[model samples]
Target: MTSAPPTETARNDDQAPPPEQPAGRRAAPSPVWPGLRALAGLLRPQRGRLLAGIALGLLGSLLGLAQPMAAKHVMDSVGQGQPAVGSVVLLSTLVLAGGLLAGLGHYVLDCSAESVVCTARRRLTHRLPRLRVPVIEHTEPGDLIARVTSDTALLRRTAPQAASAAVTGTLITVATVVMMGLLDAVLLCVTLTVVAFVGLVVILVTPHIGRATRHTQEAVGRMGAGLERTLGALRTVKAAGAEQRETAALHRAAEYARRAGVRAAAWEAVSTTLSAVVLQACFLAVLGVGGARVTSGSIGVSTLVAFLLYLFALAPRVGQLVEGVGQLQIGAAAAVRLREAEALEVEEAESTEPDRPEGDGDETAPAPEQAPGSHERHRHPAAVAFQQVHFTYRPGLPPVHRHVSFTVPAGGMTAIVGPSGAGKTTVFALIERFYEPDAGRVLLDGRDVRRWPLARLRAAIGYVEQDPTVLAGTLRDNLTLGAADATDEQIAQVLRLARLDTMTGRLPHGLDTQVGHRGSRLSGGERQRVAIARALLRRPRLLLLDEATSQLDAANEAALRETITDTARRTTVLVVAHRLSTVTTADRILVMEAGRVRARGTHAELMARDSLYAELASTQLIAFR
Candidate 1:
């Protein structure tokens, strides 16, 4: 029979289960221009390539603009009864050169865009592992993944396309209009009036596109989050026969995304189609006015022809202007998402991480160094002391630790045993500094842990969590995750110490065998052994094992018990104990209830003097494995 489990308090010290967020709700949208500014900032690193693309684009537009004049010259030469060969050749050359340059510029801009996304992704991923525990706890992993993937991808199209179109399209459109004015002022006036009306419509429409795109992206994030939620626990869903239920839930999320996408497309379609329509309207107006002028000899036919050619050229450029504005809105919306991700709370000021590149944490662990008030008193195990500690998961909730205090001497097997909700696991969490105590100091070697640099503090401790997580990788990778520079000799030693050497011999590739996702291929006992072996390889000064032997068989449990007792001689071992066997041999034991230590003694001492300890032991709530 199960005893009342611990209050759970903050949940896993390493993996806090976050509260669910409403799918559609989010922070209020930031202003559009800031996101545009962010886009400009992203482009700054690629400025050299950016400038080259801009130059090529402008050159192409210039060539394109000159083609109308070449056509006019061709008409003039033909009317003059000349062969017109030179003018035709010039016109063909301008068209060909313009197309080639535009293509080259587009390719360059796209390459630069890819670089921008890569940088953004690196920056985001770099911050993720460093974010404060509470921040990650509150934020959705799926949504964060969306920002790194789909959100950054939006920048790829919008960054270069919008910037180039704005610069090159504006210049070319203006030049086209000026040339039209020079050809015939009356026709130019008619065209400007029509263009002005369309401009007003486009301005009104663009904000909506941005709003819709923003919503659409958010909906897409929800869909991704939903899918991740399902896949992350696929086995559980399959076991419960809830596949169709999850399918319907995900379908609803996808439907929301689809509806939002249609809204964005509607706004974009309106803006693009109107821009084209206005140009056509201007063309008809110019044609009618120029036709009357030609008949009355106010303007010659070649002049009319060149002016019409200018209008025709202006159509595409005008469309570019509209498209650029739309893409800018979309890009800015994406930028906002990235900006928010960057703003999440971090574990520290990052002063210690200055030398490392973003996403470079895997390459090398930071060399441990002492902080200002940190101690170097021992060549031996680390001592832990929690004094007058107070903690709550969040405000308006009962405190998880209320004036809780404990001290453990260096180099021993210390077990924390308690009923469910008694906050036993919280001891390890506080010692590791995964959370901060509200009212008291947690000391490592007589120095406040807060005074220690995060990297240095974490480096000194090796933690094997309750329900240990094994990432998808080789057995060697999982074992050496914490000890990045661990040698094969040390790995072999830990494997034998954890009773895994025999298991490895049976495996096809031994230590190199794939563990599958979360070590899905491994049994519960094997996973626990892997977790134990990983911690042992770290060679930590303080080793934390939360229920280290809870999943093992009788043989493995007895073997691991011996291993733990032996390791305690070399480094401090603190365990949160549920099984009676785990606590019986501990050098000392703390019996906790309602967030405070109620008893401290050996098993015999507790059994003799404490009613709660005696009751639990008799009932096997401090369970016998």
Candidate 2:
């Protein structure tokens, strides 16, 4: 379903505001011209096919013109009492040939239009993923989907119909005018006078068509967004019994779109009616003026008949020209929205690895030495250190992290426990570089993380979000998302480590069983385990676990805690622990309140020194025990 266009506030939140128009610059150029130009550019790569289609359309139009002139010859021959059989045959052949050419031309133009839409969709698909995190967060996914699907599809209708009608209609109109002028200059002048007035009317109504079209398209987008919002949280909406309210909201959006569409149709209808009126007016003027001239012996009867035929042909062509302009306006409006989406800032593409040094042949060297008390081979865990980090979601907003400083040694487990909204998750976000700190340095393995290639930096770290996400797919698909090349044996190993092996055996299709949307078919513990297994598949040097056991039962949570502890022997582990039982055994713990670390020590040390930590241990932690 279509949705309303995003509001100015939504657009601004999704992207930086448009640059201010320069002083003295004519109010920002109409979106129509710029959008049309951009739409034309999309076809530039396929111009060969487009031009061929256009040429064929013109050929068809020329052939169509030939039919009227041929009919005039037959009429003239019959008036002279000639046999006229050959002329009749010639006219029949012209009609057949014109139909054939027109059909072929239409087919080719339709294919070209499809190709243009496909190219647009492919570009948008590639571009959307490259957009920054903040932009994606603010923009509705449904609106973006609409742009890729419905908005681009509009171009399929727009490109060929608009181009063919505009080009072929103009060609036919001009050719017919020339033919009429040859028959009689006085009649041609009379016909053109009516056409001139129609042209003025069309020019006056064209802007209204564009404005209405843009509004209608935006309303459709909004409707789609509304539907998406309701459906995405279908359970919540149903549980709250707000279905009627949501449906009413969507109806309002749909009504707005319907009204805008009606307005556009009204203007288009007026334009079309004016074209038809112009044709009838021109025909009357030509017939009356030509009849008078013939009586004066200024033109032959056959010439008058031929001129009228040309005028008859000219009407549909003029109507097509007007309709084509309307289609072009609609297409240009869609193009403007597409262009706006494309103009948003995107993150630079990252390579999989950093550049290697010349003659550096030690790629397979032994792993770096593990920190004290660590016990695991292949331990090359990355040491993370943050120095005075300061960050906020927006400039005017309160900071989420204020001069945060901490370190997690290589190949050891560090736990961060704090009250809600204490910036524990924000710390993970900074380490992942999802958001940059306003001021501070984050180091990985004693080197500034900013200096590492983005892909390399991210590949070296694995993060399991607090609320795990399980895509709608088979167990195997979800497990292999991070490690597509992982072997069956490796998959089994992680499943066992995460304690998901037992559940896998009970499934009807084992690993092949569909997990359903967001793993709705799986138990909460299974879903969490699947998420952990997926992360473990990457074999990351630094693992970030945010409430990894939050949804697990006691048995499952105990198993997961053991897995985390075991994993830390070979990889650096930083966990945001909600239940103190999960982190009491960690090498060190950081107590955070507000946005800063209030204390740092082992569980025993912190419980002895910090009042908040002592209280939390006695309350939340002791209950779990």
Candidate 3:
């Protein structure tokens, strides 16, 4: 009979790796321009602040350019044996002012960087919830998380460096060169030759650095995925005694990241060391060539001192220019990854129906609402139907649901039972509209689900997945996740109904006690009950529970099962179960096989009429268990 599927991460990672990762081609890494465009788009919203920062940096660079002139004046005064106090004071003031401007400029840029990261993160969070289920199925959660965390961080840190390099650094380098030429054109030629050669060397080495950085980041993402996979199944790994094997695999991923980092560092080292060495060589060459000019009276001593000071100024500028290019490269790569993640298809705003003509029919025309007080129940309930629905997790794969069709009336318990991989759980997936059917319609309350406002459709139903998920939070937080405005009485009521009142008494902080990561601190049965209580609190018209009672002990399962039967008196309930004992009391039981609904009847009816159901009842499940 049907069982809950394995952990979602394991199923996704094992069966369908992401195209953006190792599978390759479907979402290949974008070329240079697209990444740059993505980076530009991220910065565009912050242009006002970013530009203000750049203006400050430019002003600072101009101030720094004037310092050499101020120093030259001081030198000239000293050489002439005149009072140099005024010149010295000018140089000191320029130094202090330049420092202040630079600090202010960097501060503005950092704030803009932080704002960009914040915006990118918000966009990711918004899109992620609405992404079509298949995209998430194919991709690694850890890698997606890396894009939100690591990639945005890269964008923030490198973006500021790029801005300063492109503007202030280049402008300073050019202005310094102009001043050097004014001092002595002949000596300027020697300095330019050394700088130009080293500049070409750095340029030649930079593309390699960029490629290495991209590889390193990709490796880091893979390592994160591996770690997440392990941590997510920590208990299973420990029970299986496979910790060494898992650790060794993670080590391999880490080693790959380390090697990629080493390659990036080597290229960076070459660029930086060459830049430093060339500056020293330029100083020596200018000293050698300009001394000859001094002997020949081509320039004054003050002019030589000033030219050398300009070269000193050029050192930081040239380094900035080189470093900026590298940061741009790194930022561009991170931007590409971020863009890929953001590009994943998001569910459109499904809460609003399109505007219609005054005479147009109602969107949920003749909505199939339950008759007022028509049943033994005395509350709201949803009607659900599937009509010839077909679906697959991915294209080119065999369909999970083939010509599947079923229906349930309002305010009763309905159960789907079948062997494993028989598409039982997929029924819940379709009802929730997590994945669209390749053919036919899924109707909720007599309206095609696609035609219903997505939010309205979902709000009417509560679904618990095959694997009960309990996020790290307080016990109360987990209980109230679906119903934020739930009153304390409502919480207390469900806690008692789900047999959790006893559990709370043992908790150190009762409802306020922290549920460890994924509720790791809770037993499997405790987590399942917490999930059930959360769903009940939503007060949904339709409640779908897949393997809802799988984790519970026989005693607790029997208790919860009675609660479910009572809940069906007032609301629609659908369950997927492997144990026949749980569903024998259901108002209707569906028998599914090989993606098709083979039969439908109560336990007694099926036992009398169908061999497959009889065989299943007799051998597949213990009838008296």
Candidate 4:
């Protein structure tokens, strides 16, 4: 009995479905100089504030330089028996003012750095969807995620902390060195040599930093992938009682990440400690030489005291330079890994126009055709055909499929049945162009399947895999997914035909009911019916059903069988059958064994001739024969 259509039900009577989540985001690496050049533009908007902040920082450092000098002035005044109250007041005020300026500079630079990172993330996120699918398939999801989450954060720190520190470090180092030179040129010369040696140490270490940091990031990506796999298969792990094995696997992955991180941290610690040691050595040298000069009256006590103050003033910048170099290595390493991911090759686009057959200028020439219909009607040049196809997953391994040849007539129910390793699924994979055949020509509608635009070709057929992936959405949305603009009456007709609407009447929202993640909310039979309804909406000329009704109970199985039989009369249906009950009623059966077609006949005919078919039918058919 045909029921009233779902559209007859009122709108706004059901709960609205959740919107689909946007795809994951990834970070892109910028070319070294070009990325830096783009970064400079981010500073332009706040240039006035930046200049003001930088000026303040310099003033602060200068006042800080004056504090010890002022102490020396007080010391000299006391020795000469003069009042030093005015010198003390001036030094204290300079110290207070410099502190405020330094604080303001840091705030401005930090704000600018955040703005730069935000701009970079927005641009990269926008570019991701436009990238070709093949490139995305080849990349690791965890690696891409790390670029957006971790790598971008690292860059944010680099902009303000590393860049600004290096600048301030430079100005202070130069100013302090000059002040020391005024006191005694020999001591200043020794200090300059130590600073140069520290720079050499940093430069030698920086290159290693980039390589080590990249390895660490890669290890982290691998660990994330392992964790994701374990979580996704949580149910399987629990049922198989393999929790211990899974835990061990994850621990191994985490250990790899730890090793990489340790290597990077080791280099960073050594570089930082060595720089501090270098600065302290300079401090000792300045004190020793200046003390001797003061004793000989070559330099005054006040001059020697001021020189010692200058040495301490230079320390932060020297340390900052060391830290900045270390950060540069990390950024470089991350950039290289990101670049490696981005550089994967994409599948070449199909040509819009194919070359004509040689010596065939006629538009309607009768091409070499297949056998005239014996039991077939309206043969239509074999909807799909495989010629001389030979495929192997890897070189030197035995071929999974060898020299297979067949023609599937358009517009009928054809069933392919086989044992476990008969390569039944590989045939479907080739038809869908998932993996290119090593040596074969797969023809669809009389032309090479690869020649067709990937989107256009896929749209022509409706495919339901063995384990149908049901995305989270409303029951109505799943039915109308392939044809969103389908009319309410047409949608209702399909739902009833697929037997999904029978369950919908029991649902609170009928067709508008929400199916949870992966359609886990729906029973197995309901999910299969929903998938059938979805394919029916497309009105596809070719329907590829892989174990389409395998999950149904006895009552639901009968309903699905009726639906498949009814649809077969109007469209071509190809199904992979594991149960003999399904194929016994099929119009024709192709028995596959060892990747080759062993027999082709109606059920009774195959049972009479083929021992494999006879044995399989008796055991698995459930008396349907």
Candidate 5:
């Protein structure tokens, strides 16, 4: 039977389901071939360098073929009692030249591979910020890092080495077989038969190697994700005395990775052992057959000896070829992961027009700026209107905003008060176009927000989130993030407005003090003030404050409230108020409940007309007393 829809009470913030884990390995069907293609595409741009490397490799292999012939000539001369010093010296020269050429070829191949990896990393980095917000929300941070770091590194180490070995080894094997035919066609047939059987076995085993490697890489990613989760919440885990449980969880993930690696190693061992066995078996077969031919005088002793030497040379090439195939499988698996990351949906590119400073003549221009402390203004502030806007986080989920409609007039403080799940934050998300409404329009200054260039539209707005983020840097660095060109005077003006000037003066280094990781060095109230100061420096036309005073004590909260009120006189202010005191004096108030605006008016009007609003006001008022 179908379950009933969730009731309003069931939709509380704490009860919402966590995001689903990605399907990962199971989601991929036929990952190997696609990964191989991706690898090829990545290297395609560097094909010229790759081809040069291949040519050099082939030259080195061909030169190597002459060594055995030279040795044979030297042996024949020594046996005949002729002068052999010249032959010996010639043989040494061939060995030295071939080694040098092969070394140069290997060097070129490695350089090309590194270049491909660098390009892949750059693309992944560039694509990250462009990905849609929902994609980022669902992805694990550590797993994403694994793709860019470990997985790409695997591709770099494996692709060119494998390609060069496979190509050079195959060519050398064919050339050796041809030379063997010239010596004796029957012996050539025997060698060909043995090689053909070994090649078939390697081909049959190759796909399993790819499958095992793909699983191994995925397990490593899972392990990384688990560790990141533990580290991110380490303090909470320790405080709750759940360290043992988190440790066990991480141990299990590590064990999973270990098992996967073992499985891959097992497959690789099998491939290597089979290649070794092929070489040994072929050597015995050639020795026995060639012994009979030498005894029967069908082939000369020296000729048979030279042919056996050539067969000996063929063994290593064949082994290298098989090893290269195995490495290719590993590379292909890594390529699959990289391709998956690159395939995420990215945000639409911003308009081609260059971003102009605020108050440009374009329709998206910011409101006129007033002096820092000036309250006088003649022009109207930017107006924000929501007309029947609708949104839901995912399909089949209940809407977060159901035909929501409201308007905030220019140049005043407008406060939003709501229960935890009443969708107060969704309003700001729509206005910022982080999300698009399903049915209706969100207008900025009477123009649909979607029509404005994304960059320019954001430039005219400043937002302070409830959980303020202060990066690991000096105070000045964090404050200047949104306004890189802010002068010291402008910086001081914002600090004064945020009531942070006093705090800065007390610090040992003032603005140069390090914030530590995520601003752990600062007190909660100070961090919130710093966030406010950062936003103010932008001089935005529309300022969004989401629970901006939640971390402040009574004194700081009151000061911030006054500062907000002052800011509203010259620019539009929309705040999601957690405490009723912050909005009691707001010029207009919006009371929201169950994803709808239940009432909108002055605080007194809301208390007199709306029962829910009256209940909320009384609850907070009682707590305050």
Candidate 6:
């Protein structure tokens, strides 16, 4: 009879992987325009808001132009004789209104930017979960985090600011030049000529400024990666006494970030300050020639005053271009990094052409109802088989598992024992379909396993990892990890069978007692039993236990062995054994050496025949005793 399915959500690695180490020589940075063009797509949906922002910014820039003109009018009026109160009031009001408009304009632009960012974050967060396991396995967590969080934040801030500034700057500059021409056409010509030169300089410097900014963001991400590496290995570092070495490594990464940041800042400062300086120089020239024109009766003092006011109004807009250039560069750099992770290969769910019922002979047999452990419709009780399975992490790298072929039949417990790097864990990994074999097929009951949806296939087998991950929850909750939906009676029964029922009885809250992080609150043996109870709760047809008893003491180990011996009678058990006890107790042992099974037989038969088995039995079996 089938058992209750696990009610718990599939435990997942929600965190992103580290950034992929760049291959070979460092790639030369691409032109920023492409990144900017890519960013433009993000803005398309908010074009109406963007346009409104630009319009407001232009009005604000025009109002700002009136501020200096109003001050000049007040000065001229006072000098002439008596200043008109009405005129002064009107000019002051214009200046005040302009300031308000500028503030509102900024708000609108920022709002649009926020909208774009929200959309991008939503899209990326959703996509991350859907990504293939292999893609996530190959990626770096820190770099992906930087892209999703930090880089996107930068884009939101920069895009709107740049767009608004570009619009306002263009309008103000043009308005100022026109006002100057009204004062004295020849003088305006000289002023605008210098302004043109400044514009040219800004354009020439913009691309480089963006490149430098992008490099700065990347350097920062690398610093984060370094921090992650250090933290992940904190225990190892402490054991090895390598704190100083890690500190130095982090410092180097920080230095690179600092250098990149400084370079970006320097370029921004130079470009902006130059624009201001050139504008000032142009103002001086306009003044010198306008003074000559006024004396010659070719221009009025009021006209020259208004022209200078317009020029000063143009400064904020011009300054924005410089800052915009810097931010745009930063955004581009972030995009490149983000794009790297975005390009990961997401695996699709395999097609399941349900098995035909014997009498009906129809092609569409219902897919198996998913339970804690349930096989697909086509699944039969043959065995696990790898037919010429070839696998690799990346192209051109040596294959991790090459042309590996093996079989473990149903109804008997098979122990696969091998040395480190013999691709032992990889066998479990392939069976679970964490990755597809590059070439070849994995068969279960003579049917290619790849034909089954990964979820259904994994549900068919109970897996207990070496580390035996246990969440922080009640003891009962942990025991029912895979069988969340299991009834209390079923839970109580499993607890009794795994020999954890006595522990549960002693607990202050019975089964409800909280288990701390990774079940640290429990003893090693208790944790192992909890995992076993969890697997057993599913009444799995096929049980996969990976070094389940490695953490237990002798007494607990014996108890666990007894439990496993009982459970195996009702299920097909395959174990990756680290202990000789497990190997000896296993009905049959498959001794693996260098990614291939070298020998397979009962413990006594193998020990009596195979030299390697005999040697292992002598050394490790004695150690087990």
Alpha-carbon deviation at 267 in model 1, angstroms: 0.6
**Model 5 error, position 72 (Å):** 1.6
Best by TM-score: 1
Residue ranges of candidate 1 with Cα displaced over 4 Å: 1-25, 349-379, 622-625
Candidate 6: worst-modelled 10 consecutive residues by lDDT: 1-10
Q: How well does candidate 5 match the true structure in TM-score terms? A: 0.91
Candidate 3 lDDT, 1-625, residue by residue in tens: 3432233542311222224332211344456667778888999999988888988888888888999899899888888899999988888888888888888988999999999999999999999878876666667777778888988998999986597677787788888899999888887898789879877976788777777777777877888888988998898999999999999999999999899999988998888888888888888888898888888988888898899889888888898888887788788888888888888887765532344454532343333343221232125787788888987666666667888988898889998877666778778877887778898777776667776667666767778765788999999999988678889999999999999999999999999999999998999899999999998888788899987888889999999999999999888999987677776889998988778899998999988887777877776454311
lDDT of candidate model 4 versus the reference: 0.69
Clash pairs detected, candidate 1: 5-420, 5-421, 6-420, 6-421, 7-421
Query: In candidate 5, what are the lDDT values of residues 1-625, reduced to their tens digit?
Result: 0011122212334223346575453445345677679778888888888888888888888888988888889989989999999999989888888888888888899999999999999999999887766676667777888889989999999998888888888889899988888888877878888899879878888788888888888888888888888877677789999999999998998899899899889989988888888778888888899999989989988888889989998999898899888898888888888888899877775542345555533354344343111232223456788888887777877787889999898789998887766788778877877777888878777667776667667777888876678999999999998789889999999998888999999989999999988798998888999999998888778899988887898988898899999889888999987577877879999887777888999999988998877877878732311
Candidate achieving higher lDDT, 3 or 4? 3
Single out the weakest 10-residue window by summed lDDT for candidate 5.
1-10
Worst 10 residues of 2 by lDDT: 1-10
Identify the candidate with maximal lDDT: 1
What ranges in model 3 sit over 4 Å off? 3-30, 351-378, 620-625
**Relative to the true structure, how large is the alpha-carbon lDDT of every model?**
0.81, 0.78, 0.80, 0.69, 0.80, 0.70
Residue 404 local lDDT, model 5: 91
lDDT of 2 by residue, 1-625 (tens): 0000123222211112232321111223245678688778777777877788888888878988988889889988999999899999989888888888888888888898988888888889889888876666667667777778878888788867688888888889899889988888888889889878878987888778887877777777777878888887777789999999999999998898899889888988888888887788888888888899999999988899888888888888888888888888888877776776677667664522354464533233223333211233225787888888887766666677789998888888998877655677778877877767889767776555555557667777788877678999999999998778889999999999999899999999999999998788988778888999998988888899977888898988988899899999998999888687787979999888777889999998997889888877877643321
Over 4 Å off in model 4, which ranges? 1-184, 291-310, 349-382, 472-494, 502-517, 608-611, 621-625
List, residue by residue over 1-625, the lDDT tens digit for candidate 6.
Answer: 0000111112221111223453111435667777777677767789999888888877877876666666766777877887568668978788788888878878898999899888878777767776776556545556566778888898887887887776667767777667656656787688768778888888888777877877777777777767877876576788999999999999998999899989988888888778888878877887798788889988777777776666665556566766666676666666665565566566556644455345532233233563223533213332677888877655655565668887777656887765544556567777777667888777655556666766666666777776677788888777776666789899988887778889889889988899986686888778877888888777666778877787788887888888788766666788877678888889888766555667788888898888867776777733321
Note the residue pairs that clash in candidate 4: none
**Local lDDT at 416 for model 4:** 82
Of candidates 5 and 4, the better by TM-score: 5
TM-scores of all predicted structures? 0.93, 0.89, 0.92, 0.73, 0.91, 0.81
Report RMSD (Å) for each prediction in the order shown: 5.4, 6.4, 3.8, 10.2, 5.3, 6.5
| lDDT of residue 604 for candidate 1 | 98
Question: Positional deviation of 518 in candidate 4, in angstroms?
Answer: 3.5
